[model samples]
Target: MTGKIRGISILALLSALAAPPALAQSAAPSTAQPAAPQAADASQLEEIIVTAQRRQQNLQDVPLAVSSLGASDLQDRQIRDTIDLIQHIPNLIGNNNVGLGSSNTYYIRGIGNTESIATQDVPVGTYVDDVYISRQNANNFGLFDVERIEVLRGPQGTLFGRNTTGGAINVIMKKPSATAGGYLEAGAGRFGETDIRASMDAPLSDKVLTKVSMYRNRSDGYVRQVNTGDKLNGSDNYGVRGAVRLLPTDRVTIDLAGDYVDENEANLINRVDPATGDRIATIGITQGALAKYFTGTKANNEVGNSTKSWSLSSNAAWELDDLTLNSITGYRQTTQRYFIDSNPAAPNPIATGVSPILNYSLHQQWSQEFKANGQALDNRLNYTVGFYYLHENNWTDLGTGVGTASGFTVSGDRTIKNTLDSYAHYAQGDYK
Candidate 1:
């Protein structure tokens, strides 16, 4: 739903947090089938492989209720980011309610986290290339050169461990291709929106392969400021990823990958009356105070959200006679800064009332996991066991200023820090 204010489209009046792109061979503008390999029989269905149980198996063979989107599925459906999965995955919901450009709040079966604080944990765990992402901030990443996306629809504590009480989401990136091939894509949308995406795959040798992918997008704000003729509720963000796959031998494989993302977005806008908590009038002489404030002119100090993050990971596997041994190690860091102009509608800048809120966060974490999977009893029994370790530290800084008729006050800035160290051994087995 949308409206217009003085010939300007009110694309987004609720908050500057406006939310929710395109393609390649799997993402071309054609109505082609998904990337899953089809069975030789014409009447047979395509075989969809999944790692929901920490092992590759036919999607239907897995007992859990799973939703899988292959590369072609994502491209055909235009599922450009993490948030877009909600539309296609049943009983799933996501949004950028955290107010950060690259942040997200996801709910699966009505269980999830809404706060962006560093101390709290998200019930719904998120993973990329088998590495866990502990923080929700900057988790809303742009999807490029993806292999598949899997959403597990129930408690996954057995295999995923803590924070999986709700469920889990897995993003499997496209590994370096054996053959040399890639694609480039560009797109445009309303409100001066534009984006570019590209990926390239190169094989250095018979045993070495490498690939890189990147994307960037920008759009004008939908909510227009009549005074300055500038729009609010806009975003500018970009990300890049590089991967290398080493096939030391037929029975051993190794993968090394790293990625970085940056985001800058407009600040949140007040669209409702603070006193009565009613919708502010955006039209005519009866315009509410907040609406009038939006139209009125003032000093332009566009204090918004700026976030930057990066990570590196390595994964290796060894295939034995009857068992598969795997190890994964990862390290990640993030920094975010944002501010809220509490109130500029006050009659007096220093006395009548105004409060400004500012926040800063710095976080980093590292984790390692070793696991083994195998089957016995004439292939009727399947099992997996793993040991995991993790360490993380976070720092948060907060500041605020208040104004009143009597006097003005500025609160001293404060910082909060938290650190965590965890270790556990888990095992799961299934028998027919």
Candidate 2:
């Protein structure tokens, strides 16, 4: 939704306070699918805009099970990330892989991926700015600068993809406005916690507009190491997003956006001995390394995890009277690395030390989509047609020290890579 800045747009301002993504306001051209209301008595309640079918319609009018949370709703609830909303949404579970930062497993309606391996697939699909995130390692991030979130339960294999067999998490980012205005905010809390968020929207000439948003958060953590006094389960992360929109003609609109995020946190430990409620002291793990891995309440290992990622996207639309043509292009890259404290309490051990075991996962993807939508039969018939293509490359590297309980040590390494391409052409129509 864009145009005349008559009075004040409260939704825009409130959304700026939270700084959402620059998701386009219009829907992609796709077949008409039945809408199902995830909420009861939706028609009697507030009218929510829905796009589960790749067409804009009211929540109550759609024939699919869907739920939505607007930007203001998320901000009022102080929902900063996916983990915060998981508990509130029914049947939606986003596990952080027992304290690993880069591992996020989302279970919607109890049908998500069970394996933590990077080469596997996720039943529930997640999208940001209409671009499929595909992998969970990059799915868990601060939901700052968002417009709204739509949760569709059940198989969404029609318009989305096979990965959406369980459901889809649709995220729309706030688009840049022709109006020139912005927002800033800061806060502090317990455990040395602090939050800083800001966003700015500006118009360059009559046809070009741009917006930039960023946020930073940190915490001292509640748990600590018994031996080294190091804080566990703490976070230090920052992210930034920028976009430029150009109206080259009366019928054409173009948008280019880029985003980057860096996450560094002390992961929660994964394992603890049941007998003594203590970490298994390994013969190869040092006291300090062992302490760091199992320092906190949810102990697993000594070394935490770190991740860095970036993305670029372009969306263009052309209106041809009653018919509209839309195109989307996207590219993304992400990397995650984590380590664990090896136990030294083996039956036979001469050297007691902590083994540094680490794994690095990387993902790169590019996608293109073209769509056409129009109406016929005295405006009673609505239809959509689209073509989609995606190319993805993923790899993993595992590095660890192989050792025996009898004081043995050897370095081990392994790497694997895979490439995949997908294509689809779809069309559907409905008569009112």
Candidate 3:
């Protein structure tokens, strides 16, 4: 064991590690204190807790630049999706392209993808709880039942790994609590939009608790199809999430979560902006067919999309005397298809064989993470060390058939598949 190149001993650096100046926090006790807790007053400012670094801390205490939206902020602002969030946050923008609603493009600090292609990975990293979502297309998520959303600006190589080169976002869902309570909600909006949501939390016993939440949203598409003269672009979506908490012991906690989203809507098409009353200019398309791009135009604008996604995750934490160990495992999959009429106009005898298509894609991802976080030297030092592994597989179907109004049919079809596997080990410490 001794026949090796002489190396510096890690022990020699012990004196170099300085501890930060902060009060050490004691782990949560098993039994509640006999004294009743004081109620917080709404009129007074409250403390905001965040897990941006894989550990809970006051938002103001974190060293990095961060922005956060809480559940109340989301509801009061009517932010149902990340797209909606773009309006409130600075230096953020959402792609104006017709998107199916699940994974839309977003720009943070001018870093993001302009195209909606599922294969491209955007620079902004997104995480659900502690699980990292690698691909940009998978970052678009519904904002229902979310506890908080934290946007961390700048590179995060230590905790989040490569995908956070631009930045990172963490979406935290409300987990099951040791309580028996529930609520129901419903709302209506313009454009035939209606939403219904319900959630219930109950205790299975003293050691186990569970919670389930679901919502259904429906709205009329604003555009009109040429063939059926039916409403074209609109909203139709629904999603549900469920969670369970196992507290077998005071020091050990386990959380299991599963959720699914189904989105069905017409493919995004060129249309006149309602507010501006201006017809959208077509690119690479003839001027004569420009009128067909209007939302209510009679050209056969037959297009639609069906997007489905689901995810499962487990988080286990063991609280020790001065530290916490966490294990997070996750699996996610998505399937989406975009259907469009190659010829939205009347089929001409000359171009009878042409067909138009956007793209169909399938993706699956799985990851595992282990983290150790805690205080050292009587709360003077804060540190986090973790390992992460991620694997992804994606498949896409491409259709090619270019025909003028003369009716050109598709001449070729192609398929592509990609697989990726990567892992990382990282550690960081803050000593005051």
Best by lDDT: 1
Report how far off residue 298 is in candidate 2 (Å): 23
**TM per prediction:** 0.79, 0.77, 0.78
- Write the candidate numbers in order of decreasing TM-score: 1, 3, 2
Summed backbone clashes in each candidate are 0, 37, 16
Give the distance in Å from residue 127's predicted Cα in candidate 1 to where it truly belongs. 0.4
Top-scoring candidate (TM-score): 1
lDDT of each: 0.78, 0.74, 0.72
Per-residue lDDT of candidate 2, residues 56-114 (tens digit): 88888888888788989899989887767686677787777545655567788788885
Clashing residue pairs, backbone N/CA/C < 3 A, model 1: none
> Can you write out model 3's per-residue Cα lDDT over 1-432, one digit (the tens) per residue?
343323344444543453222212224354655757768887976789998777898987889888889999999998887768778877766753344545666667777765555566767777898887765544566677889999888887778888676677789999887888988889998779998888899889978999999989889866654324456557688899999999999999999999998877644444564566633211122222422322222122225666788999999999999899999999999877654444433233122322445556788899999999989987889999988899999887755455544443445556778898988999988887
TM-score, cand. 1 vs. native: 0.79
Error of 2 at 2 (Å): 49
lDDT of 3: 0.72
Off by over 4 Å in 2: 1-44, 270-302, 341-357, 399-413
Residues forming the 10-long window of minimal summed lDDT in candidate 2: 290-299
lDDT of 1 by residue, 272-378 (tens): 54565533212111112222222111112244567889999999999997799999999999988765455635433323444654567889999999999999899
For model 3 the local lDDT of residue 89 reads 76
